[model samples]
Target chain A: MLLAKIRGTLVSTQKVETLDGLTFFICEQLDIDGKPLGKYVVAADSVGAGVGEVVLYVTGSCGRYTDTTTNRPCDATIIAIVDMLDVDGKTVYNKTDDA
Target chain B: MLLAKIRGTLVSTQKVETLDGLTFFICEQLDIDGKPLGKYVVAADSVGAGVGEVVLYVTGSCGRYTDTTTNRPCDATIIAIVDMLDVDGKTVYNKTDDA
Candidate 1:
């Protein structure tokens, strides 16, 4: 799992039937320093996460472990809503800090 | 799926049983221009790709579609050994060019 911030949503009316009922989120990967790593992924949203929220996403076959991604073609999925980030015992990010 | 080049291998003695019999390859993601994208992933090799070979890898649930990755914890898997890469009708990468 990696840290990412939900950037936006992807809406597609025309897609494979297996992809139906899946919500996609455009996620910007974040480095340990909380900066964008200049990489982005469109991940299926397994959790009801909102835009701008920090999340943890799983990739590959493990992504299918979520109820929403089972047997789907999804390669990425937001699996968790992050509340805080701690690095080397130091708090780097805390959701409460956000107004 | 994404484009990547196998860089090295990873051996682990301690891991989940599902990961057993899985050969892990360290791969560097590539951009459309065939340049390294500064991202790396440890992918399970579904295809017989070797180090220095450019290959296509699948992630997420699709990564599990392969016989070797089914119901496993893998998130990335090399799905194809690329023979050529055509970008906008031009071959930017060809395995033959490596020789």
Candidate 2:
């Protein structure tokens, strides 16, 4: 699993039939310091996260193994909305208190 | 390599020195049909990609291999800005011509 932020949303009217009714979101990976880590990716939005929201993501087959994404042509997914983060014994993020 | 759409961006003020000055973006994986495939991820933005742009991303150790991301804790990165996509024989996206 990895920590990231929702960057944007993608809407495609034409695509594979198996991908119908699914929502996709772009995510920017956050380093331990919460800085933009110079990287980006497209992911399945399973957690209903919006742009600018911090999130947790999964990759590979684990990302494809979900109720909404099972057995599909997907490699990434937003699995959770992160409320806080504690890394190396420090409060990196506190959703309610920080914002 | 995989096909994705840039969703958003992330900015952090504190983090590992190695991760400084890097940009992270949110991404949603796209299926062959150009629909949201119900998956999302955080990727390091190697290219100057913006929201709503289609991009190519790499994963695993390959993602961490770059001038800005070498020897860091990362799993994904956007390697290129996708100008078009053709899967199983179809024009899903053509940047210059499509909106």
Candidate 3:
């Protein structure tokens, strides 16, 4: 799992049949310090993360373990909305701070 | 899965027990044009690729789906050795040419 920030939503009608009804988000990878890494991924939204919210995402086949993405060709999926991030015992990011 | 060039081998004796007996390779990711993408991954070798060989590597949980990597904590695995790579109707890479 890695940290990312939701940038926006994606709606594609002509996608693999199994992906229908699942929302997708445009995510920018974030470093531990909560800064964007400039790399991006389009990921299926399993946790309903809003734009600018930090999320924990799983890539590759692990993305399919979620019930909504099971057996799908989905390569990335937002698995959790991060509430706080602590690195080296120091608080780096707290969802409440952004709220 | 993506294309990568084997750069070297990796041997870690103190790793997750499930990863024992699996050969690992250091790989550099390649673009469709066969140029290095500047990203690297340490992947378990499933196909016995030698250094400098172009191979197909799968990342994430899919890496654990292979017989050699099943139930392991591997995040990457080389699945196939590329014999040739063609892009835009042009031959981009050929193993024989390198040999």
**Which candidate leads the pack in TM-score?**
1
Q: Which ten residues in a row have the lowest lDDT in candidate 2 chain A?
A: A9-18
Off by over 4 Å in 1: A1-99
Instruction: Write one digit per residue (lDDT tens) for candidate 3, span B1-99.
Output: 899887655433322334458776657789998888966566778877787789998888787788887755456788999999888899999999989
Query: Candidate 2: deviation at residue A71, Å?
Result: 0.9
Give one digit per residue, the lDDT tens place, for model 3 in A11-91: 888988888889889999886667788999998876656888887666777677666677888788776676665543456
Lowest-lDDT window of 10 residues in candidate 1 chain A? A82-91
* Docking class of predicted structure 3: incorrect
Error of 3 at A27 (Å): 0.1
- TM-score to true structure, per model: 0.54, 0.53, 0.53
- The total of clashing pairs for model 2 equals 41
Candidate 1 residue pairs that clash: A60-B60, A60-B75, A75-B60
Residue-level lDDT tens digits of model 2 in B18-58:
77777888898875456777689898876667898877676
Question: Cα lDDT for residue A59, model 1?
Answer: 80
> Predictions ranked by DockQ, top down?
1, 3, 2
DockQ of 3: 0.06
Ordered list by lDDT, greatest first? 1, 3, 2
How does candidate 2 fare on TM-score? 0.53
